[model samples]
Target: MTIQSAFAGIMEAIRPLYDAREASNIAHLVMEHVTGLGKLDRIIHKDGDLPPAQEALYQQALQSLLELRPVQHITGKSWFYGMELTVSEQVLIPRPETEELVEWILLDHPTQPAWRLLDIGTGSGCIPIALKKQWPAADIWAMDVSTSALAVATRNAGIQHTPVRFVHQDVLSPDASKVLPSLNIIVSNPPYIRESERTGMQQQVQAFEPGIALFVPDNDPLLFYRRIAALAKEKLEPGGKLYFEINEALGQEVVALLVKEGFEDVRLKQDMFGKDRMVRCTKKEAAPADTTSPS
Candidate 1:
C-alpha cells in the first residue's frame, strides 16, 4: 500500500483505543521508526508505496497500540536528556520528571572536576547515564535490586557510551553499607507511588511496568526516601546533595524528612505543570572543631 494509505489505515485501526491526537502521534512515531523519515519528508514523499514487509510491521505496531502498550516500549527505545536509551519490560520507562532531576543535579554541580555520583534504583540507567553524558568527567555509580533491570541498564550504558558503575544490591537491605561509600552526590527516582494509588493509574502502566520499581508500601509512603536519606547521611560527603523525583502530594512531608535529617537548602521544585515534583537537599557543611578548651 502507498504511504498515505498505510498511515490512514493504521490511524483508523488505533483510533478506537486512543484520542485522535494520541493516535496520530503513535502513527507518526511508528512511521518514522519504520521509514526513518522526518515529518516534512514523510509528507513530501506521501505517494511512495510502503514495501510489503514494512506494511506488515506497521500493522503489528497498530495492533500493539490498540492493546495500550506504550509507544516507547513498542519502539524499544526512548530519548532522555538528548540521549537515546534502550527500554524494556524489565525497566521502568524513563519519564520527563526524572530528566528534571538530572538537570537539577547538573545545575547544582556545573563543573565537577572529579565528582562522584550515586544513583539508587537506576532502572534503565536513565538518570545516571544522562548525568554522565552531560558531565563527562563525573564518576558515576548506579545500584539496583533487580538483576533484569540492571541488565537493561547496562546495555543502555554501553549504547550511550556513558560509563556508570552498576551495583547489584538492594539499597534497602540491612547489609547495604558494604556496597555503598561516601560520594559527592546521591540521586534517586525511587518507588514512591503508594500501592493504594495504583487503581488510579492507566492500564498500560499498571499492567506493563515492573511493580517493584513503581510502588511503595501504603503504610510507609516514604519508605525508600527514609532508607536512601539514611544511607546518604552515611555515605555522602559533607555538602553533598541529594535529589529525588517526589510525589507532588508528599512535598511537605518530604521536606520535613530532609530537614529532620539535618539537610540544609532543602527546596521543592515544580515540574512543567507547576506541581511539586522534585526535592533537592544539600548536606550542611561540617563545623570546624573547637580550638579552645571549654571552661
Candidate 2:
C-alpha cells in the first residue's frame, strides 16, 4: 500500500475508537515508527509505496490501535520534559501535567548546587530522572510499590544515564518512613483519581494502564497525599519544599491538608489547561523548646 493509503486506512479503521484528531495523530505515530520517516518526509513521500516489511508492521500497529491501545504503549516509549523514556503497562504513562510539576520545581530551585530530593510513586522515574538530568549535583531517590513498575523505571533511568536510587516500598506503609532520609525536596504525583471516576476515563487508560498507579479509594481519595505529606513532615529539612501533582478537583482540599499538616507557603498552581493540578509548600522550622524553668 502507498504511504498515503496506509495512513488513511489506519485513521479510518480507528475513527470509531478515537476522535478525528486523536485518530490522525495515532496513525501518524504508527506511520513514523514503522516507516522510519519524519512528518515532513512522510508528507513528501505521501504517495510512495510502503516496503513489504513496513506494510506488515503498519498493519499490526493499526490492529492494536483499533483495539484502543494507547499509542505510547504501541511505541513502547513516551516523551516527558523533552526526554523519551521507556514505558509499559507496568507503569503509568508520564503525562504533560506532571512535566509542569517538574518545571515548577526547576523554577523554584534553578541553580541549587546541591540538594537531596525524593519522588514518591515514581512511575517510569520520569520526575527524578528529568530533575537529575537538569541538576546533576542533586541526590535523587525514587520509590514505588510495584516491583514490575520499578523494573521499568530502572531501565528508563539507566537509558537516561541518570543515577537515581530506586527503592521498593509502599509510601502508605508505616515502615516506609524508616527507609527514607531527610531531604531538601520531596515530590509526588500520587494516586489522586477517585475510583468512582474510572467509568469516565478513556477506554485505553482504563483497560491498559496499571490501576495501582492511577487510582485511590473513593472514600479516601487523598490517601496517597495524606501519607506522603505526613512522611514529608517528618523527613523534610526545615524550610524544605514539598510538591505534588494533585487532582484538579481536590486542589483546595489538598492545600488545606498541607496547611493542617503545618506546611507553610502552600500554593496551588494550574497546568497549561488552567486546571489546578500542582501544589507546593515549605516545611516550617521547628520551634525551640521552652528553656526557662517554671517557678
Candidate 3:
C-alpha cells in the first residue's frame, strides 16, 4: 500500500479518539518512526509505496493508537527541550508546561557558583535532565519511587550523557530527608491531582500513563508539596530556592503553606496559558548581627 493510504487508514481508525489535526500529527509521527523518515520526508513522499514489513508495523501502531495509547510509547521516543528522550508507561509523558518551568529556572539563575539541584518525584527525569543540559557543570540528582521509572530515567540520562544521579527513593518515605544532599535549587513536578478528579482527565493519560506519578488523595492534594517543603527546609542552604509546578487553582494555598513554613520571597508565576502553574520561594539568608558593643 502507498504511504499516503497507510496514513489515511491510521487517521480514520483513531479519529474517534483524537481530533483531525492531532490524528494527522500522530499518523505522521508513526510513519516517521516506522519508515525511518522525518515528518517532512513523510509529507514529501506521501505517494510512496510502503514495503510489506513496514506496512505491518504501521498496522500494529494504528491498532494501539485506536485504543488511546500514546504515540510516544509506540515510538519509544519523545522530544523534550529539543532533545529526544526515551519514555514508557513506567513514566509520565513529559509536558510542555514543565519545559516552561525549566526555562524559568535557567532564566532566573543564569549563572551560579557550584550549585546542586535535586528533583523530587522525578518521573522520566525530564526536569533535571534538561537542567543538566543547561548547567552541565552543576550537581544534579533525580529520584523516583518506582524502579521501572528510575530505569527509564537512567537510560535517558545516559543517552544525553548528562551524568545525573538517579535515586530510587520515595519523597513520602520517612527517611527521605536523610537521602538528599544540601541543594541550592530544589525543584519538583509532584503528583498534585486529586484521585477524585481522575474522571475528568484525558482518556489517554488516565489509561496509559502511570497513575502514581499523576495523582494524590482528594483529602490531601498537597501531600507531596508539604513533604517536599519540609525536606527542603532542612536540605536547602541559606538563600537556596524551591520551585514547583503547581496546580493553577492551588497556587495561593501552596504559597500559604510556604509562608507558614517560613519560606520568604514566595512568588507565583503563570505559564503561557496564564494559569498560576509555577511557584518559587527562597530560604532567607540570616541577617548579620551588630558587631559594636557598649563600652
Query: What's each prediction's TM-score?
Result: 0.95, 0.94, 0.96
Give lDDT tens digits, candidate 1, residues 1-295.
Answer: 8778778987888787788998898788888877778889989999998887887787788777778888888889888888888999888989888888887777877765478889999999999898888888888999999999999999999998989999999988988757766798999999989998999999889988899998998899999999999998888899998999998889999999999988999999999889999999988889999899889
**Model 1 spans with C-alpha error above 4 angstroms:** none
Candidate 3: lDDT of 39?
73
How accurate locally, in lDDT, is each candidate?
Answer: 0.88, 0.92, 0.90
Best by TM-score: 3
Q: What residue pairs clash in candidate 2, if any at all?
A: none
Worst 10 residues of 1 by lDDT: 105-114
Q: What would you estimate as the lDDT of candidate 1?
A: 0.88
> On a 0 to 1 TM-score scale, where does candidate 1 land against the true structure?
0.95
- Candidate 2, superposed: residue stretches over 4 Å from native: 288-295
